[model samples]
Target: MIGVDTNVLVRYLAQDDEAQSPVASKIIDGFTPDAPGFISQVALVETVWVLTRSYKMTRDAVADTIETLLRARELVVEGAESGYLALASYRATKADFSDALIAHGGRLAGCRETVTFDKGAASAAGMRLLGAD
Candidate 1:
């Protein structure tokens, strides 16, 4: 499998770069299940950040993008189970995708609880409050 960078993925999905989009598409779309492209967790997070912060994609759209990536047979996502759990949490709650991913990753790692100072994460992502009374 070949590793995919965040920029390549963003270029492919966004299709906004006139000079790079076609090339990104050609490489990404050419992948097959037997020779899948691999997306790392860092790249995935960066892609989400760019989609939301830069592209201003709506929550539903971001979710759809992530779901599409997860379901793609020509791609291998790192920590896929955690990604799925995070997606479920993101869809069902007010938690950010990164927070939900952190919580789910902790759970998968056998953490009794993930402690956090962010109330949104604590309440929405099932993380334990670090200093709540």
Candidate 2:
């Protein structure tokens, strides 16, 4: 499988770059289930961050985009099961996608609970609040 990076994904999804979008589309379109484009966890997180923070896409839109990627036959996202778990959490709560991913990754790795100082992460991502009473 060929590795796909955040910029390529962003370009494809955003379609904002005049010169790069078509190139990104061509690369992504060439993938198939037999030889899929591989999206790493870091790339996925960064893509979401850019889509949300940079592009100003709404939460629902970001969720929809992630869902599409998860279901795409031409793509193989790393830690897909964990990604689904995180996606569900992200949809239901106001947690950052990265925070939800961290919580889910911890759970899959047999962590009893993830500890976090961020109150939003602790509350929304199912992490245990550090030093909470």
Candidate 3:
């Protein structure tokens, strides 16, 4: 499987860069289950950040995008089950997808609870509040 970078995914999803979009689409569309494209956990998180922060996509839009990526049969998403859990958290709460992904990763690794100072993460990302009273 070939590893896909965040830029490639951003180009395919955003289609904002005319020069790169076609190439990205070609690569993505050419993948098959026999030789699926690999998307890393890091690339997935960065793609979410780019779509939301730089492209100004809404939270629901970002969640939908993530769902599309996760569901693509030609794409092998690393940490996908945890990624799905993160997507669910992103859709159902105010927690950042990145934070939810981090917490989910911790949970999959057998963490009892992830501790954090961010109230949004604690309340919405399934993490424990480190200091909030």
Q: How much lDDT does candidate 3 score?
A: 0.94
Ranking by lDDT: 2, 1, 3
lDDT winner between 1 and 3, please give it: 1
Residue by residue across 1-133, what tens digits does model 3's lDDT show? 8899999999999898879999999999899989999999999999999999999999989999999999999999999999999999899999999999999999999999899999888888989988758
Best-matching candidate per lDDT? 2
lDDT of 1 by residue, 1-133 (tens): 8899999999999999999999999999999999999999888888889999999998889999999999999999999999999999988998999999999999999999999999999999999988857
Report every candidate's CA lDDT. 0.94, 0.95, 0.94
Best of the two (1, 3) by TM-score: 1
Runs of candidate 3 with Cα error greater than 4 angstroms are: none
lDDT of 2 by residue, 1-133 (tens): 8999999999999999999999999999999999999999999999999999999999999999999999999999999999999999999999999999999999999999999989999999999988857
Candidate 3 lands at a TM-score of 0.95
TM-score, every prediction = 0.96, 0.96, 0.95
How far off is residue 104 in model 3, in Å?
Answer: 1.3
Clashing residue pairs found in predicted model 3: none
- The TM-score between candidate 1 and the true structure equals 0.96
